[model samples]
Target: MKFLYRILFDLNKEIEEEAIKEGIVYVLNYYKNEFILYIQAYMAEARWLNNNYQPTLEEYIRVSTISSGYCLITATCYIGMGNIATEDIFKWLTNKPKVIDVAIVLCRLMDDIVSNEFEQKRDHVSSFLECYMRQYNVSREGAVQEGRKRIVDAWKDINKESLMPTDVPRPFLTHIINLSRFMDVVYKDKDNFTHSEGEMKAFIKALLLDPMKI
Candidate 1:
């Protein structure tokens, strides 16, 4: 597992370097900084757990949850930055409003999984979809529909705001959809070893790539 962790860390560094070379430096830096903070937090939690009680499956889940939360945050940041940077060299949205929304939801899902409050049979999709739905104050089905709608709407808004209409292409949108699909598949296969370290490294690499290069 230590070897696997090192491989993942090295792959993450490579991805960050790639993003920086492509002029998405801020995104890579932001995520890398966040990851460091998360690691510190995880270490602190582990120390407390070690001192206070016997290690259990629950403790293991907490550690995994922290790692997963960091992964999702960094992944989303990479995607958002890569998308914005691909089209315009200097035209970047510093706010990243949509990405923030998604991150909050993803974090909540991670929390539920870590705390053992998420029901595999009943709450997986519900918890995942809740982020968008809660933001819009809509039902689960409504939220799913709204989430898709917002993605399209956001594209249009970006087109209007950027003034370079053709800069961000449809393939970028397709990539995001594909990424969401992959996340769904992974969540569904949580019981199985569906994700390998190498696969995750590849996914991060894909996210870090410039859309034109991809």
Candidate 2:
């Protein structure tokens, strides 16, 4: 525990020094708070696992979306983003506004759909499928069907959110949507991230090697 505490201390000290040098100290607490929420989310999942406790879909989503780390990732994206990443933008993100929440929720459900079987083979915590199935008393396929339906609904919500006029800037919304798209690509029909030898390799090659046509 002492070693762990020292490592955490060193990480914070490093981030604080960098943030100060970059004149972005205003985002430091936001980053730290997001990390705290991320850690607490994992701890909640662990406790549920240890106690053999099953959460309802709503309860599971509440924690799982934080565990998705989208908020933390977004905060990290803003750390050195210069003038555009105002403190107000960070505050907006921290409040868990509707659009970003839908994005991460889409990410979480898509991941669970593609990864639940492999996760279940281990001593992992119950995934979204498990929670939904348990709550609704549905079969595995039924749960999957329902999960996909929710994902489609989330995408519809995201589309509506994007099309409507809003106070938030477009870049931030686009960035969050990009993160969701990444999750969708990596975990759509399979765990493409883990089994990266095939399509993922091609994706990288296309992204890096093959130049775009003009």
Candidate 3:
């Protein structure tokens, strides 16, 4: 954790160097607040676990979406985006824009869907599946089936948001969309990220060795 803190602290210099506009420097302060919120999201989940609290689906989504780290990654990605990421763009993202919101949701759901069982076995906090099943009085499979439906809907929302005309640059939106897509691929069939030695490694190796015919 200390190493992580040091890296985050060092990012101030890096971000300042990469940022050109004076307003971008001011926005860096705002991003620091985002960093705080990110940590708070994780702390909230820890508190829930410590108290043995079972969050409602709404409550779970509110926190887990932030805890998913997609928003933070989006912010960090934007901070270094040279000039396209202007002050207004940074402020807009800080407001939790719809495209980023849905991406965060998509990521959290996919992660929980694939990792819930393993986490449950380890006596971890209640995941979205458990919360939904408890509230809706459904079985695990039923909750998962519903969850899959939500995932499909999330993809639709992502596409709609990205494709529609907007003020934010297409490249910035691409970062959010691509992050969600990455989550889809990583957690679709299994938690390949956690077990990266298996499918993840093989996929990387193949990608590096194989050339695209197209």
Best by lDDT: 2
Model 1, residue 39: distance off in Å is: 1.3
| Residues forming the 10-long window of minimal summed lDDT in candidate 2 | 75-84
Q: Number of clashes in every candidate structure?
A: 0, 0, 0
How good is model 3 by TM-score?
A: 0.90
Instruction: List clashing residue pairs in candidate 2.
Output: none
Q: CA lDDT of 132 in candidate 3?
A: 96
Sorted by lDDT, highest first, which candidate order results?
Answer: 2, 3, 1
- Whichever of 1 and 2 has more lDDT, that candidate is 2
Off by over 4 Å in 3: 11-13, 20-23, 207-214
Stretches of candidate 1 off by over 4 Å are: 53-66, 70-83, 86-181, 188-190, 193-214
Query: For residues 10-102, could you state the per-residue lDDT of candidate 2 as single tens digits?
Result: 977887887888787898889999999999999999999999898888889999999988898888777757557888999999998898888
TM-scores vs. true structure, each candidate:
0.40, 0.90, 0.90
Model 2 CA deviation exceeding 4 Å by range:
1-15
- Predicted structure 2, TM vs. truth: 0.90
